[model samples]
Target: MDVIVNAAASADGKLSSRRREQLAISGADDFARVDRLRAASDAVVVGVGTVLADDPHLTVKDDDLRSQRREDDRPGNPARVVVDSSGRTPTDAAILDDEATTYVCLSEAAPVDRRMALADHAELITAGEGRVDLLRAFATLQEEGLEQLMVEGGGELIFSLFEAGLVDELRLFVGPKIIGGRDAPTLADGEGFVSEFPTLELAAVDRLDDGVVLTWRVDDR
Candidate 1:
């Protein structure tokens, strides 16, 4: 399974802008690109924090795009995969309520009762925390037939993957508005957070009217 990072941030690197209440801050092109990325993947993933902050449907809603998502080659909306590291994902989340398939990647430490409850419909995988093992989770998903995985991260989960060298590609759309707060979250920790990320080679750079979109592959090798 290949992990792809798909996200949007403020020009100043804040994930949700300093306001943290409005999502309209994300430019049109960035939102479009995110949906396009979802159309191309087998699974769309988000961390628990994102679930709470943004109750996204994670489905392509555009009329034409809906058909495109249901084609033979790249058909059907991708399964919604949530990273609920501690089984803390709200049981009533829209992601779980929707008719589409849903999955929860949680830690082994999750209570047996909680695991049983979540397993009612959503598949639950015990990917431990701190040193949470993403490799095992990826292997499990691959065996289950998921190939391309797009991760729409919050913070911690993104940092973990980059630090673990599990992220293969990154696509970012940065809006121009400067929501300047001393403490705003960035795109997990791609290159300069927890530690210096393995240098990534730029793949594409396009400037949108009020934002910049960047694409990169981890090294040419």
Candidate 2:
């Protein structure tokens, strides 16, 4: 599967404040760009942290875009996927709405009751023991015909994807604002790399809104 990781951060590289609340880092043009990216993907994935923090619908926003997907014999919106290991995703989350198919990835350790509850709202995929195995989950997604995946993430998930060597492209939008806080989330924030970092080939750069967009292709080392 083609995996694209996309995010917007402040000039200082913070995704949001230390409070972990949702903040608008990109402008209208960037928003439209993201909507287009979503429309082109087969599934849009995010971690449970992002769903709890942002509650994003993860749908193609443009009416014409939805129409185009339908005309192309695709769903009006791509499937919404949540990498929730312990089934922490709220049943009432926006992604659980009937707008599109929802996939909740869970680990074997997830509570039976929680799994049962989520099964009513989403298709459950078990791929690991303690934590959701992203690689295995994604393989299952690919088997289900989701060939192109877009990941809009919290830092931990982004870090895991890179650590698993699953990311293919990185599109980052650096906005003009500066949100300075040591605890603030950045583009990739898990146990950061200490040795061989993932190499990226600079592909393109373009000015969008008041900031700039940098596209990088992950180099196979």
Candidate 3:
């Protein structure tokens, strides 16, 4: 599968505030651009933290943007995926809404009853032990026929995917504002890298009204 991580951060590389909440970092223009990407992808993924914080619908909003996919004989919206290792995702979460097919990737330790609860709204899959093994999750998604996966995330899931060598491309929007806090979230946050960091080759850059969008090809070299 071709994995692309789409995220936006402040000038200081903060994604949210100290409370582990979500903030509107980008404006309408960048959001529309992101919607187009979502509409084009076969699957859109996010971490459970994002669901807890924002409870986003995870559907393409623009009728015009959605119609483009339908014209191509694709689903009006992409399959929505959530990485909830502990089966913590709520059944009533917005992702469970009827707009799209939802998949919840849970850890092997998830309780059977919890799985049964979400089964009505989402197809559940087990990937790892205590936490989701992203590589295994990707393979399961591939086996299920999702070729292009777009990850819109909180930090931990993004870091796990990159650490597992799954990311192929990155789309980053950097806004001008500065949200300064040591506890603030970032683009990637997990076990901090112990060795050299992975490099990304710049593919493109666009200057939007409120921010700049940067595209990078993950340099596996």
Candidate 4:
């Protein structure tokens, strides 16, 4: 599967404030770009933390884009995926709506009752023991016909994807604002790498709004 990680961050590299609330860091142009990306993907993925924080719908937004997908014999919105190891995703989360198919990736450690509850609203895929194994989860997604995946992330999930070498491309919009806080979340925020950091090859750059969009191809090591 082709995995793309897309995000918007402030000039200081923070995704949001120290409080972990959702903030608008990108402008209209970037929003439209992201909507297009969602229209093109087979599935949109996010970690549970993102769901708890933002409660995003994870669906195609533009009317024209939805029409295009329908014309292509595809669903108006792509599938939605959540990596919730312990089944912490709220039953009423926006992603669980009927707008699209939803998949919740869980670990074996998740409670059976919780899994059963979620199964009514989503398809459940269990992998790993203590945490959701991203590699295995994505492999299962591919088997289910999700060949192109777009990940709209919380930093921890982004870092996990990079650590597992699952990310193929990164599309980042650097906005013109400074949200400086030591406790604020950045682009990648799991247990950071100590050595052998992942490298990127710059593919393209474009000016957008008051910021710039950077396209990078993750170089295989």
What TM-score number comes out for model 2? 0.99
- For model 4, what is the alpha-carbon lDDT of residue 133? 92
Per-residue CA lDDT of candidate 2, range 114-208, in tens? 99999999999999999999989999999999999999998999999999999999999999999999999999999999988999999999999
- Measured with C-alpha atoms, the lDDT of residue 168 in candidate 4 is 97
The C-alpha stretches of model 1 lying farther than 4 A from their native spots are: 17-22, 73-75, 129-131, 189-196
Candidate 3: tens digits of C-alpha lDDT, residues 1-221: 89999999999999988887778889999989999899889999999999999998989999987899899998899999999998889889999999999999999889989889999899888989998888888899999899999999989899988888899999999999899998898999998788968889999999996889999999973
TM-score of each: 0.89, 0.99, 0.97, 0.99
**lDDT of candidate 3?**
0.91
Global lDDT of each model? Answer: 0.76, 0.96, 0.91, 0.96
Candidate 1 local lDDT, 24-49, one digit each (tens): 55666667777777887888888877
**What does candidate 4 score on TM?**
0.99
Determine which window of 10 residues in candidate 3 has minimal summed lDDT. Answer: 16-25
Please provide, for model 4 over 1-221, each residue's C-alpha lDDT reduced to its tens digit, 9 standing for 90 to 100. 89999999999999999999888898999999999999999999999999999999999989999999999999999999999999999999999999999999999999999999999999999999999999999999999999999999989999999999999999999999999999999999999999989999999999999999999999973
lDDT of 3 at 186: 92
